[model samples]
Target: MSSKTLISVVGPTAIGKTRLAIILAKHFKTEIVSADSRQFFKEMHIGTAVPSAEELKAVPHHFIQHKSIFEPYSVGDFEKEAIAQIEKLFQNNDYVVMVGGSGLYVDAVVNGLDEFPQIDSKLRDSLNQKLEKEGLECLQEELLVLDPKYYHLVDIHNPHRVIRALEVCLTAKKPYSSFLNQKRKKRNFNSFYVGIQADREVIYERINQRVDIMIEAGLLDEAKKLYPHKNLNALQTVGYKELLEYFDKNFTLDFAISEIKKNTRRFAKRQLTWLRKNKNILWVDFNTEPKVILEKITNQLKTNPHA
Candidate 1:
């Protein structure tokens, strides 16, 4: 039997990754393992742009809404669980699909996470205090100054991410980017990347439309329900954060919605920045037919049987 392969469908949000992954999984008669970190929480549905009920029914999906927001699910946890799930799936099928926009979680499963030295607890506490007192911009600015490369690739609006990178920079006196991809751990299965690409204007339009659809589907109500737990790491995302600002009277609802669209675009840009660094990815037009994409993937696999 051939060694198992992991087909990672990666792209910016709202670029139709879910649809493409489902098509590929169905073609391969396999299941999907979601790497979208925000989609892991059950409480965050519409905001995370999780697969619709119809889409989920079209293919068996693992890791989507499999955890609660109250739980502290780190990238390491996701990497372990995702690998276990993929291994189990490979027992039944030769190929399994992994899809998401969260580059860190995806890399955790693909390249393995880079190990960092343990910083002092006091340093974390001090950073948290600074974040709470001075705001995310303060931390973001510091990160940009300390590690401009990582700043371009990271979700700047995420405080947890910003603070984590800053902690490494401050402690090690080195740019956080310096630690990444220094060494890659071997995996049992072969990995293939399929990146969906589109024109910048088209991608932004798709994101704006998706945000509008989410609003129509009651994203505000969903955000309101999760607002009380806004401080939680899982809730510190694009849609929820903007809505929480409205709930806090810091911005009008109209302004908040616009902010969500703007921030989501920025998030997509960051995702593309991270993905572009991977020169091995097989880029395809976003509108390419599923059958064509599948054929391309299969041909690549055949030509590089040892990959």
Candidate 2:
């Protein structure tokens, strides 16, 4: 068995996942490969919550802010890129850290993605027209009816994710969830999952606080700068989406910020929902000290050396 292992640090947003990942990276003297799809765009910074400059310098990081909002990037593209980066890093270290709240991207790196049948472009275009005619919630409701399992797990606010799932469901005449985990492809390195969780109240509070901090840190100005490109796929994320709606004069600024907090809490709930389905991850309390968590991880590494 290969000794190399990828420690995937996953949790809801504002749960200190980056802190834990950095500690592990330092301990292993290794690098980190980010799987958060939102952090991939160069145009989005404060809204996506890219790591602080000091954090990036503390350890070498990859796949963060490496692309433009205009460039087309998908989970499949990320899976390929992350695997290649991990292979390169594994040449010098036995363990590398992968951290992100984006469960699909993290899972794609750990368990190879299921092969999706080719979706018809016209069908996708039709969905887009429907989205335009109605709104994001229209397609979100349709997806809930078609695939509740995925509907609960996905960011229903993301038009791309919702429409993509709908396209597959409509084409295959089955729940999009049914096609997942059909097979787990083999990889050269083992994977160990570490998840952090907190009480619901605690998680929501943190998310609310984080949103306020982002606002104070000039999130509105950043969103204003990207207002022209709000139609881009990368701008379809949570923090930026609500702000973009504000730019469209859909509501008051205060209401927009509140919506950001509300939507972010819902997003975190969905994140936990998707993450809890994986039985292999060793979940730790969000407030657990770094040394204690590190001790648990090291113990697992020693006990299950090959896994």
Candidate 3:
């Protein structure tokens, strides 16, 4: 490998990214910089499948459980911090591994993020009033009208996404689509993009089983502890938000669990869709034997040693 090569392993949740990243890091004798957004919060453990204790012991990790739930973290923040961390790691390690399921976070590290304009507090207050008075559905509709393209790509159920899109569209009198043209910013180091893939049935089965495991591991209790903060924009995630509905008596535990699996499946599909658009990704099907997959990556690294 060239000096300070960066390897990224990205995929849908439960596609074995954690295990594969650990193995790759061990093989390269390097450490990991996590791009998983949820795994960054110290209070959120079970819900976010953070590397198990043993895996963390096996390979050094950065950015895991490094923040409080209340902290205001953004993809831009992650981009800046992760780049700085990777620069430091490059001083010692040749190959730095980045692993996560969050497509936006990974993109932030690999490709520099856009420079969004400063938030207008008045516009935000008006949007917040609309959210409280007419509900997120109103903001969702507005976003769809203003930028149908982004509306289709964004998490439709996320109120924050809806509000932000509306804020830009209303204030700028333009589609949010204009700002998301995906211009690739230059990076200091070469990056090899690795993605994990599996059969759809296998992936869905794993997602369901993983949800069951999360519930058994006290995901409900964790949700209960953070129930008061559920309204926070950061807490509007798949596992916790579904459980918040259960706590509100809007759904049973069984139904909430079902919703979690369903939402996660849709999320996985979206993740794959996002990754497929990037031509740089080298896909490794997890269904194949580990030896075979490792050989593929090893061969690629040998052929293109610069990355």
lDDT of each: 0.92, 0.93, 0.86
Off by over 4 Å in 1: none
Error of 2 at 223 (Å): 0.2
Tens-place lDDT per residue, model 3, 1-307, is 2456789999888999989889889888899999999899998888888888999999999999999989999888899999999999888887899999888898888877765666799999989998899987888888878898778777777788778878888878888778864787877788898888999999999999999999999999999999999888767888989999999999998999999999989889888877887887888888777788779888988888554
lDDT of 1 by residue, 1-307 (tens): 3488899999999999999999999999999999999999999999998998999999999999999999899999999999889888989899999999999999999888999978888999999999999998999999999999899888888999989999999999999999998688888888889999999999999999999999999999999998888899998889999999999999999999999999999999999989999988999999998889989989988998545
What TM-score number comes out for model 2?
0.98
Worst 10 residues of 3 by lDDT: 110-119
Best by TM-score: 2
How many steric clashes does model 2 contain? 0
For residue 265, what is the lDDT in candidate 1?
A: 94
Model 2, position 239: C-alpha lDDT score: 92
TM-score of each: 0.98, 0.98, 0.94
The C-alpha local distance difference test score for the whole of candidate 3 amounts to: 0.86
Q: Provide the lowest-lDDT 10-residue window in model 1.
A: 298-307
Candidate 3 global TM-score: 0.94
Better of 2 and 3 by TM-score: 2
